[model samples]
Target: MTRRDIEFDAEGVTLRGWFYPAEGATGPAPTIVATHGFSAVKEMYLDVYAEAFAAAGLNAVVYDHRNFGASDGEPRQEIDPVAQVRDYRHAITFASTLAETDPQRIGVWGSSYSGAHVLVVAAIDRRVKAVVSQVPLVSGLANLYALVRADFVGGLRESFDVDREARYAGDSPAMIPVVSEDPLGPAALPTADSWTWFTDTAKLRAPAWRNETTLRSVEMFTEYEPVAHIAAISPTPLLLMPAQHDHLTPTRLAIDAYERAREPKKIVILPGGHFDAYVDGFSVSSTAATDWFVEHLQP
Candidate 1:
């Protein structure tokens, strides 16, 4: 496997990551554009899948979202769902221009929040030939309610309102921790396990990872609905892999989305939590992913 540094324009900001050429690709090969979930950088685990894809004769392009990792952007450590989705489109366009991969055979893969982004991208972009969504964050409201207690729910909205006003007044966006020891803290993901897994992964593999995002990033979820677009992606092969015991994304949402999905779709329920897909969970998920890409991309 060989990797080279790469960058692409998402609107005007520059986002960067690595591009791995297929090990035995003799010509333009199938390609998959991939990235990480909320508050995560590519080095955390995307390389594990990209390396496998490259070894299997599939070109893999992994990149950091703007304002995170090595990507260049202002208002550092931001997480904008809409802007990130746009980046996926830019990445697909960039991947298609690569002489080493087949643009028409391009696919997309993502986990956690990005897992949901892949769904929306595939629905709107016919250029995406296939998709792999692992432990996808299906609904914004459901995800928010799960993280915050009922009593503080109103308080949460107040905070968002106040922050919105501050931003409108030209004040810098308030920052918040991406995860916290207390589920009630001013954080996005407050589960103890989420905190442990994120911190551990950052220390072990992703020194570039940041543990915070602008407060405004949280509100983007309220308007984003990936499930609404799942059915529109028919004829294009879709693979939904959600852990059986996923605590964060919730298995029920993925299953509901699967029920609504049309033919040319497959779902694998792994026996672990959401982060399991990163640890021992990758074996089944990646194996199925390789087979799916080979069948659909056929390059």
Candidate 2:
């Protein structure tokens, strides 16, 4: 149950978070490289999952994504899926170098947006021997249309265009709330559950958590297609956990993406909305991921 504050280099950015060494481990242990989704920081229940893995005799390297949380990056609060994907690989490299980690026995666990990132990472990174993608975004375009009203789609695109021009003119990137009190209001995640989970979690756990992100972050999200690489994750052992009624990263999308993924994969449907995986269904979600890593990574 020992945890330490740690930092590592991702490209040029310094990402920081807590690392938990496996309890009662004798030597280098199988490790999982993990991070939060979208604009979330490590403090948003990532520690809870890491502790579960560590208690199960697996080393866990949990860190913040660049430009978020304790991580160091410029044009702060920006989220570029491409950059985040590269950072996941860098995290793998960082985990591989740790004395307490078995480089050959590495896994990756990501939830929500990061859940999709792990899918893409497992496809291209041979270093990841096992992967757990929880309530992941399969297709950005699809998820966007699912959450946003059809009539407002055009207006949303126009906002992105306007932000692009402002940024080009050297103005600071326009920002938007990650979640809002009104589900009908403008926000990156405009669901009632997202609003409740994020606001409540921030108040109870991570006060430093911000509710804003660069407007361009939403633009980048519309173009990400992580599920396209789901099939490539085969032979590496994939565990796709989607919530039963997830609306943010709709359950159907995750189920469909799981179908596209090759064998050596298993799907476990959680018993609530998307945010419930980190709250009400945390035990189910964390235990599933911990056992998957132990079975495949052999920690």
Candidate 3:
């Protein structure tokens, strides 16, 4: 196998990425660009997915969004939805120029927050031939509403506190633990498996993955909705894999978005919550995703 860490210029930002090619493979092959989700880095998912695609004779490009991970940017952990989408587009453009890649067969893969990004990117950019959104958060408002309903007063207080700290520290607002020990709260903050996945993954990262995102991120996200553009991606294959018991992103939202999407789309519902598929013990969903990309990209 051939692997290289590369950097590319995108919208005045220097994006960091990794390219993986199968060993002894020659000539161009189908390429997939994988983007990470909120508070996650490229290194988290790149290795597993890249190896899967590369073993199937496909090249994979995994990139870190600017302002997060190893990518160059100020105000670390600030979630800029527009910038994230732009980075996705730049990754595709960079993949297209690779001599070992089939530019016309480019695919986009994303999960959680980025899952929605993949949809919007493919809709606006006709160059994207295929997309795989795993347990995607189709609507920002839906997610926030869920969060609020779970703990209206507490959620509001937390948001304000985060915003204050962010401004005082001259940084983006920080979020509470996705899973906590408290009761009567968002399941994402209390689930045992969610904690395991995050802590274990943090151990594998440098500086221990400190992802304190801007509190105003919610404010920005409330106005951004990827489901609104699903129809724009007609003719291109879209795979929607929603976790049955997902708490981070409700499965119903994903199903609704898939139903609204145009022809040439597929929906696969797996058993588990939002983060289950990313960790161990949820091989069904992960395998289904791998197969979906392989089938569509046709390496």
Candidate 4:
């Protein structure tokens, strides 16, 4: 239950993080790096998973993506998939140096956008012993297609605006609301409940959480495709936890990624939608994650 604030430099960017050690952890223990999804802070779902892992005798490191939360970056809130994947590598490297962690027993757990990130990281970094990609966004192109198909004109306009802003500022672009006011709506905006939850959560965060990112993040979709790298990670343990009714990242996409991945893998389909995995019915996915890490990393 012991927690500490930490900072590390990644590719020249000063990144912020939290380290959670098991209550009685005195010796080397399996460790987990918990990364959050797009537009979310480490304080969101990472804490939930971190506490659970710590209770189970694992040390947990949760960090903010550059440009969001307490992390340092320019053109704030811009989604850079390449940067995200790089940050994962940096986090894993940093976690390996912790005195309380077993350097060889390192696992990466990512949700939503980061789900795909962890996979890409594991593929490139043999040091990653295990991976958990929860409700992953496998193909950025497919995701964009889905958005355009839902509302072509609106999607186009949003993309144009994001691009214009990024070009104008000569830096990273911003993004629109990924969740919708109406869960069933064609275009996405934060749901009323989601907005409320974020507002409440913000009150508990530190000063480092005050940054806002640009909207030109759509560019990353065309540049980074994590699903294509799945087969390259042969023999590494992977766990895909997809929500049955996930609207943010389609369940079908995650299933396709699972099918393409190499052996030593598992697919756990849980009930509820995307946000539900963070709020209501979260225990379903959380428990599955705990068991997965215990079986793969702790062993």
Worst 10 residues of 2 by lDDT: 290-299
Which lDDT tens digits does candidate 3 get at residues 1-299? 66899788897889897899854467787888887887678767557778777887778899888887778886676678888999899999898898998888888889888999999998999888888888888898777776555547466656666678777988645554444445454433344555666667778753535635555555566667999989888888988899888876888889989999998988888777877676652467657766777787774
For each of the candidates, give the backbone clash count. Answer: 0, 0, 9, 11
Query: Judged by lDDT against the true structure, how good is candidate 2?
Result: 0.93
Task: Give candidates' CA RMSD values in order.
Answer: 1.1, 0.8, 3.2, 3.2
TM-score of 2: 0.98
* Candidate 4 per-residue C-alpha lDDT over 175-248 given as tens digits, one digit per residue, 9 for 90 to 100: 45544446544323234544554555557653344323344565565456899899877788998998998756
Q: Candidate 1, TM-score vs. the true structure? A: 0.97
lDDT tens string, model 2, 1-299?
Answer: 67999888887899898889989889999999999998998989999999999999899999988888889998889999999999999988988888999999999999999999999999999999999999999999999999999999999999999988988999999999999998789999999989999999999999879999999999999999999999999899999999999989999999999999999999999999998899889999998998899998883
By how many angstroms RMSD does model 1 differ from the true structure? Answer: 1.1
Residue runs of model 3 more than 4 Å from their true location after superposition: 150-193, 204-208
lDDT of 4: 0.78
Ranked by lDDT, the better of candidates 2 and 3 is 2
Please name the candidate that would achieve the greatest TM-score relative to the true structure.
2
Give the per-residue lDDT of model 1 (tens digit) for 1-299: 57999998888999899999988888999999999999899988899999889888899999998899899997898788888999999999999899997888999999999999999999999999999998999888887776678888898789899999999999999999998877667787878779989999989998887789987788877667889899998878999998998878889888998999898999988768989888887888888888888889873
Worst 10 residues of 1 by lDDT: 181-190
Which candidate wins on lDDT? 2
